[model samples]
Target: MALSTNRSPQDTLKIAQVRSANVDGTWAIANKAGIAYSHDPVLGVSVVSKSDWGRLAEELSSSEFKMVKIDSVAASYGALQVWSVQTPRFDNARAQRRHSGLGAIWAVYSDEKSSVPDIQDFTEPVDAVYTWVDSSDPDWQTSYSQFKNSVPAAGSHPTSRDIARYTSRDELKYSLRSLEMNMPWIRQIYLVTAGQTPKWLDTSNTKIKVIDHAEIFESPEDCLPTFNSHAIETQISRISGLSEHFIYVNDDIFFGRPMSPNVFFTGSGSVKYSLAKAHYAEASNPRLAVNLAAKLNAELIEAKYGKTTARKFKHVAHPQRRSIHKLINKAFSAEVQETAKHKFRHVNDVSVPSALAHYVAAAEGVGVPADIDYAYVDLGGNHLPMNLYRLVRGRGMQMFCLNEVASVSENEKRGQLAKRVLDDLFPYKSSFEK
Candidate 1:
């Protein structure tokens, strides 16, 4: 049946079932309410029991109200590991840190693997897990292998070992194992892959829902964009099933520690913004790069029909280098000279979603944020300046975990992981609750 374009007026909704749970009774309720159902198979999870899964499949097949919202948390959780070139530490400290912030968390993966870490000991209770499996084609293997063996080409900062370590299926296995161990805490697991759902995940007590990836994300858009939109839409769609808020996470970074949900939801702003840091700059000529980046990025601005376009931007350009001190002085003056009114709000206040919308809209000649009003935080994890720059340009936090007190790897030479409590604490904004 087609999804309802109109929104439901009801504010409160019931979770009929999420995975391998007693489906018969719940469907009885769903049937009475004339609601839809959903599940994810690839990640080995279901919201209903085996009998209920069968019943749901048949009922959904014949019923017009089979529309249900599926959470792809597991898929996303795994995908993080599958896609990234890094290994995450699985410990209690990191797990608690993540749990307390966002009420829900999911794993994402780009491919399959044999072994994974055991995370039941680290993480808090979960609302759901999401798993994503790419296509069955052989080429995915080739790409995965290449990514596993390859290091960042020259000029890249993350180092060869970091990249190589996370490229293999074994690494993914370890991560998955960790995630699987956390299953009991998860309310449901969404598998975004094709083919049959794994059998071991099904049970008479849990509920399992399996549907094609296309069902969650309709085509006409590419994968990344589709994932972004579906990520939001899928949650919004689950008005009757999920809580008001959920979480999105990358998989390569494991739950090496314990976490509390209170930290993330503690603040009471109309909106909460967070992002990973991409890059940093300490130039003597602040106006030069900012102005240049802005100008180059300005192609995104739209000129209203028959409206006049002004030469609104200006900055200094030099051919020869003076002393660093002289450069700093000139740059500082230029930056001050440029009025706040002339610059884009994104330069001062921004977040990941807004940043993406800005540039994406910019590509289409739409207006960018010249003035923004919102709370923002940085989420930093990258090995290169360009990656960091792109992440910043994309609206991610520039220094998210920089001050984290308890991290997965403390070598300083190794990658960063989510922070934990008691282990260490990063200096959070005052707005964040203690």
Candidate 2:
């Protein structure tokens, strides 16, 4: 049922900046000028001038405003985490602070007329790449044992250790399907692992290729059997026949909405990176390596560009260019070389391939920071799987990541929940599937 606003169409429409809201809830309704508004249940949100209201009363004796309900608020209330659109996480208004390092310089580069023309098409071939490994693999375990005994950095917290890190959610297959269905602009997908391939993928599909880590390491004898993601990411640029531009994503990340190439790269060829802000606080998450990576990103950007550096990045797909990789390797040859030797994560290690790539690109004038639409959910907590369903059905995200769920002898409930969520999100098999 529509509630009465008693405002005439002529008078309401005459007021250029009108506001409207639900008379029952906080949801903002439509304004007369096609702008947004909210109608308060107790105190109506719409405000019109006296002249307009009098004219409205004369023109239309009875006019009522209908309530708009996007969804039930209870839908997103997680056990602890909320996935509602009302949450600041999904909106750009919550994007981390402005880029502090080389931000101004990059802004100039981005605005330069010569850097990128307005009409350029960014459809040049780009590859999608991921590095994956299941720790349960006997060969992987053997290699891990060899490194664990020799390297002091092989430390793993007993309480925090979970198979969730390497556990396969079958999202890799779905991610491939998403590319095939949503992002046709992608040229190929390279799943990098230790000679392991998902059984369900259609390898015969010429567009997809499985890259073994042995093929990219500079010194196979030293870097082979590596457990550090930073070390492995550093070598991905060396893949043979890889395109000049590529996107790196983890197995858990999936495309939620159809997107185009232009989202990651500007018409002028500058790569876009979404910078996330981190506040000053003691490192608390059990994931110490992530915090170390952010600090390293800040240090490197500050040293070269001489400004405060943004310490965090949105957990999303990474846009990478081969040329920047080469430049960083050459500039930080010794540090990178030493990092490759660390079989496991170390406190001193720099995130050269992950966060550092964006900082380096911006400093060199080849990239600009951009805020993209995406969602992130940590299923390790008690979040309802319905959050996943709602995010897609009401897709405000181009991509989203599912994190932290694993099975064990005692508790398989979380893993089961994750499986159900994935099935619900993408039930149909894509053409890329066997």
Per-model TM-score, in order, reads 0.28, 0.68
Per-model C-alpha lDDT, please? 0.27, 0.57
Q: What's the lDDT for candidate 2?
A: 0.57
Question: 326, model 1: CA deviation in Å?
Answer: 49
Number of residue pairs clashing in candidate 1, backbone atoms closer than 3 angstroms, sequence gap of 3 or more or interchain: 98
Candidate 2 has its poorest 10 consecutive residues by lDDT at: 98-107
Best by lDDT: 2
lDDT tens digits, residues 204-283, model 2?
97877889889998988987777777778888889999998999888777765435566677666678987766642345
Estimate, for each residue in 1-434, the C-alpha lDDT of model 1 and write its tens digit.
12122443111111111111223433454466554433333333223323334444455435432222222332232223210001111113332232212111222322333223233211222333233434233554454455434523332222212322222221222223333322333344343333334333332334324444445432213322121211322222222343223333222323322122221222220112232233213334434323333332233223212221222211100001112112222333232222111211123211112222223322334222221111121223344334333322332211121221123243533333222211122111111011
Residue 292 in candidate 1 has what lDDT?
Answer: 34
